[model samples]
Target: MLLIEKPTRPLKLFSLSSNKEIAEKIAQAAGLPLGKVSSRQFSDGEIMINIEESVRGADIFIIQSTNFPVNDHLWELLIMVDACKRASAHTVNVVIPYFGYARQDRIAASREPITAKLVANMLVKAGVDRVVTLDLHTVQVQGFFDIPVDNLFTIPLFAKRYVEAGLVGSDVVVVSPKNSGIKRARSLAEYLDAPIAIIDYSQDDAQREEGYIIGDVAGKKAILIDDILNTGKTFAEAAKIVEREGATEIYAVASHGHLTKGTAEILNAAPIKEIIVTDSVKTDQALPEKLKYISASDLIGEAIVRIHNREALSPLFSYQPDENKDDA
Candidate 1:
C-alpha cells in the first residue's frame, strides 16, 4: 500500500466591519473559518486593528466593501492590508466587493483630480498584492492599478436570477439607463437572447429630463441594468420613461445597491416592479417592498479558491453551476 500526502492550502480570510454577512458566506463557501480580528476607534477618531491569527507565509484575503461611511471603511481596509503585510503574509488580496471612488475614475472637467487613480496608488502603497472587485464603474479603471486586478462581473449572477425568475424571452428587453451602461445591458441581453434598449437623457439644474427610448420597448418587459444604484433618481427616471413608452413590466438590476439617503423610497414609489441587486454592499437598511438580493459569495469564494491555487480567473467570469456549487 502506498500513502499519499494531501496538499496544504495556505489561505486565510478576514473581513472588516463593512460587510460581515457576505464575508461569512464566502468563508462558508470556501470551507474555511473566518479569520479572527478586532478593531476599535479612539475617542479622537482613529482606528486600530489587531489580527488574532497567524498569517505568516499564508495567502491573506481581506473582504471589505468601501460603502457607506466610505472614508472610514477605506481606512479600515488600508490598515488591514498593512497589518497583513507587516505580519509576513505571503500575499494580501483586497477583496473589495464594491469599490468606492470608482465613479471618479476620470476627470470630466478642468483641474479635477482622478480620485480613482489616487485610491489605487494608496492601496498599492499600503502593500496590497492584488485587488478583487466586482463590476467596476469603468473597465478603464483596471489600468489604474499596476498590480493584478480581477474585475469580476455580476452579469452571470444577474442572468441566473433572471432565468430563475422566468424573465428570459424575446419579449424581455434589457435597457441601459445611460450610454455608459450600454455594454453591461447588452451583455445581459445576450445572455437572455433578448433585445437591448438605451435611454437617452440630459440633466440640468440637478433635474433629469424625460428620456427617449432608443429601441423598441413598447409592450415588452424591460429589464434596466446598471453598475450602481446610488440615489435611485436616475433608475426611477429611466423606469418612468420605459413605462411611459409602453413597457408592460419594469425590472431594474444593479451590481451595487448604494440605495442610501431616501433612494429606497424613491425606488419603491417608482414604476419598477422589481429591483434586484447583489450583496456586494451591506443592504441592512429598511429595504423597499420590491427590492430583492442575490449573494455574490459563491462567485467570490470560487475566485478566492482559484487564486489560492494559482489558477486563471477568466472562466469564473462566466456562469458555471459547477463553479458556484455552494452558492445556494
Candidate 2:
C-alpha cells in the first residue's frame, strides 16, 4: 500500500552580517524573501542572534561567510543554527561562501591542530544538517565533516568572464603558482582551451631566481589560479616570475579575495594586469583598479533551490553563470 508522506517544510532564507549583499542576490535568484534576522554584538565582544519570524517546521538556509573576524562570524552562525533547531526548524542548511580555517586542514607540524576538522566538528555539534560552500582551500576538508557538503566551483564563472573578454586561445595559459593547485589551473585551462603550467619551487635560493616555469609561458597571457588570494604575496611572486619568463600579460583569479593587510597595494604594484574574484566575502577596504568582483549569487541561489527540493547539485561543479546574471 502507498503511504502518504508529510508535506515539505516551508523554505526560509536568512543572511548574517558576513555577506548580506550576496544573500540578497541569492534570495532574488531563488525567488524567496530574506527572512527577518537580527544580530548584534555586546560590549564584551559577545554575539547574539534572533529569528524574528517563526521558523517552526520550516526548512532554513543561512548565508554567512567566515572570512575576516572569523571567530565572530562563526559564532553567529552557530547561534543561528541553535536558534533554528530550538525553534523546531525541520532542517538547517548553512551556506558558507568562504570557509575560514580551511587552510589548516592538515597537521603540518608536531602538536598542530587540524583546525579545519575542528571547525567541521563545531558546526556538526552545533547542528548544521548540510553545508554548501564555494571552493574550499582543500577539497579533502569535505571528509572532515560527517554531514553532507556541497563544495561548488568558481572555474566556470572565471572561465565565462575571460572567454567573453576574449582572453581565450593558445596565447592564454593557466598557471598554478604552486604545484598543489595544478588541478584548479587545469580545469580553467581546459575551459579556455589553453595550455597549463606550474611554478615549482627549488631548494636552492638561486634556482628560484632563475627559470621556474614548468611549462612555456613565454609571450603568453599567464592566468594564475588559486583557491584563496590572501596576502597577494603568492600571486605577486608568481606574477613577477611569469613576467621575468617573458609573459606579456598577467592575470590572477581566486574563489575568495580576503585582501588582507597591504594586499591591495601589493597587487596594485605587482606586474599583474587584472585580478578577478567572486563576491564570496564582503570588504570595505579600498581595492586596486586591477581587481574586479563578480557575483556567485546565481550559482549559489540555484544550489539552494535544488538542495531544498532534494535535487542533485553535481551540475554546479562546472556551472557557468551568464554574463548578465552572474556579474556583480
Candidate 3:
C-alpha cells in the first residue's frame, strides 16, 4: 500500500527578537502574519518570552538566527520554544538560518571538545522538534541531531546572479579557497560551464609559499565561492595571486557573511572586484559599505513552504539565482 501524506495545516510564524526582518520575510512568503510575542530582558540579562497569541494545536515555526550575541539569541529561542510547548502548540520547528558554533564540530587536534554535538543536544533539551539551517560549513553537522534537519543552499542564488552578469559560460573560472570546498566550486563551474580553480594553502604557514591554482584562469573572470567570509584573509591572498596570474576580474561569494574584524579592509585591498554574500547571518554595524549585499530571504521563505508541505527538498540545493536581479 502506498503511504499517504497528511495535508499541511496553516502555520503560525513566530519571529524571535534575533532576526525580526528575516522572520517577517518568511511569514510574508508563507501568507501569514508574524506571531505575536513579548520579549524582554531583566536587569541581570535574563530573557523572558511571552506568546501573546494562541498557539494551541497550531503548527509553529520560530525564526531565529544565532549569530552575533550568540548566547543571548539562543536563550531567546529556547524560551520561545518553551513558551510554545507550554501553550500546547501542535509542532515546533526551529528555523535557525545560521547555526552558530558549527565550526567546532570536531577536534582535529588533541585535547579539544566537539561543541557542535553539544549544541545539538542542547537544542533537543530546549524542546526543538525540527531544525532548518543554511549552508553549514560541513554538512555532517546535521548528523549531530536526532531530530530532522533541512539544510538549504545559496548556490542557486549565486548562479543566478552570475548568469545575469553575463559570466555564466566560457572565459570564467569558479574558484574555491581550499580543496575542501572543491565540490561546491565545481558544482557552480559546471552550472556555468566554466572552468574550476582551487587554491591550496595552509592557514598556519606564513612564508607565502607556492599556492597552486587548480584550473586555468588566465585573463578570465574568477569567482571565489565559500560558505563563510570571516576575516576574508583566504580570499584576499587567493585573489591577489589569481589577479597577478591574469584573472581579469575577481568576485567573492559566500552564503554566510560573518564579516568579522578586518574582513572589509582585506577584501577592499585585495584584487577582488566584488564581494557578494547572502543575509543568512544578521548584519551588525560592522558590515562594510564597499561590499555588495544580496538578499536570499525569498529563497529561504520558499524552502520553508516546501518543508512544511513535506516535499522533497533536494531540488532546492545548489541552485543559481539570476544575476543582477533582486529576487522578489
Candidate 4:
C-alpha cells in the first residue's frame, strides 16, 4: 500500500507598519497567525523589508494603508511586494484599506500627471497579483490596474451600524456633500429607507460660494455621506448649510478618515453631532469626542477567505438601490 499525505493550505498574511491592528483582526478572523516580517528605515531615509519566514509557493496578502506619511507607507508596501515576489510566493495580494493617491485619479490642469494610474502601474510592476481596497475616491481607479481588483463597498457596514443604533427611519435624510458622492449617499438612504438630499456648492478665490440644498432636509435627521474626510472643510461647510436650511440634527460618515492639518479641530468645532469613520486608516492619536470609528475587519476577513477559496465575491458586493423609492 502506498501512503499519501495531505497538502498544506498555503495562505500567508503580513502587515506593514501603516496598520497592524486591523491586520491582526483579519488574521484572527481567518484563523491564522500574522506572518513575521521586519522593516526599518536607513539613517538617510530609505525603507528595508525582510520577510522572516519562508513563503515559497504560498498565497501572500500584505495589509497596508497609505494614509499619513504617505510616501513612507507607499514605499514600504512597494518594497514588501518586491520582496514577496522574489521570495517565490505563489501570489501577492496587496490589501490597501485606505489607498493614498486615489483622489488624484484625474488630471485637471495642463501639466498635472495622473498619479493614481502611476501608483497602479508601480504596484503591477512590483508583481502584485491582486488588489483589494475599500470605497475609493473615484471608482474608475480600478480600471487603471490590469490585475483583478476588488473594490469593496462599506455602505452595508454603515447601514448595520445605524440599524443597531436605532437611527434608521423616514425621519433621517442622507446628504451628499458634493455631486461625486450622490450614488453613495443614495445607497445609504435606500438602506435606511430614508430620503436623499444634495448640497450644491462651488469653490472660488478663498470664498465658499453659497450653496443650496436640492432636497428637503428641514426637521430631519441629516447624515452627511462622503468617501473621505481629508481637511474636513467639505463636510463642515455642508453641515453648516444643512443646519441653516433647518436640519434638526447633523451627522457625518466617511469611508476613510484621512484627518490632517487641524482637521480634528475643524470637525470638533463644526455643527455636526457626530462624525463616524471606519478603521480603514489608522487613528493612532486620541480623536475628538464627536469622532467615532467602526471596524471593517469582518468584512475584509470574509473577502480574504472567499478569494483564497476562489469563491464568488458578488454576494458581498450586493446593493439594492431600488429597494426604497420615497423621496423627501
Q: Which of the predicted structures, 2 or 3, would earn the higher lDDT when compared with the native?
A: 2
**Root-mean-square deviation (CA) per prediction:** 3.4, 3.7, 3.7, 5.9
Q: Is candidate 2 or candidate 4 better by lDDT?
A: 2
**Residue 73 CA displacement from its true place in model 2, Å:** 0.4
Preferred candidate (TM-score higher): 2 or 4: 2
- In order of listing, the candidates' clash counts read 0, 0, 11, 0
Candidate 3: give its CA RMSD in angstroms: 3.7
Reference-based lDDT, residue 83, model 3: 91
Write the residue-wise lDDT of candidate 2 on 36-108 in tens digits.
9999999998888889999999889999999878999999999999999999999999999999999999989
- Compute each candidate's TM-score over C-alphas: 0.93, 0.95, 0.91, 0.92
Q: Which parts of model 1 are misplaced by more than 4 Å?
A: 1-9, 202-208, 321-328
| Cα-based lDDT at residue 154, candidate 2 | 91
Which 10-residue window in model 1 sums to the lowest lDDT? 1-10
Q: Could you tell which candidate, 1 or 3, scores higher by TM-score? A: 1
Ranking by lDDT: 2, 1, 4, 3
Candidate 2 collision pairs:
none
Best by TM-score: 2
Name the lDDT value of residue 46 in candidate 3: 93
Cα lDDT of all candidates, in order?
0.88, 0.90, 0.81, 0.86
What is the lDDT for 148 in model 4? 94
lDDT of model 3 at position 222: 94
> Model 4 off-target regions past 4 Å?
1-9, 202-208, 284-286, 318-328
TM-score of 1: 0.93
Please provide, for model 3 over 117-220, each residue's C-alpha lDDT reduced to its tens digit, 9 standing for 90 to 100.
99899888878889988888789999999999988877877787788789977789999988889989987888789989888854446655667777788989
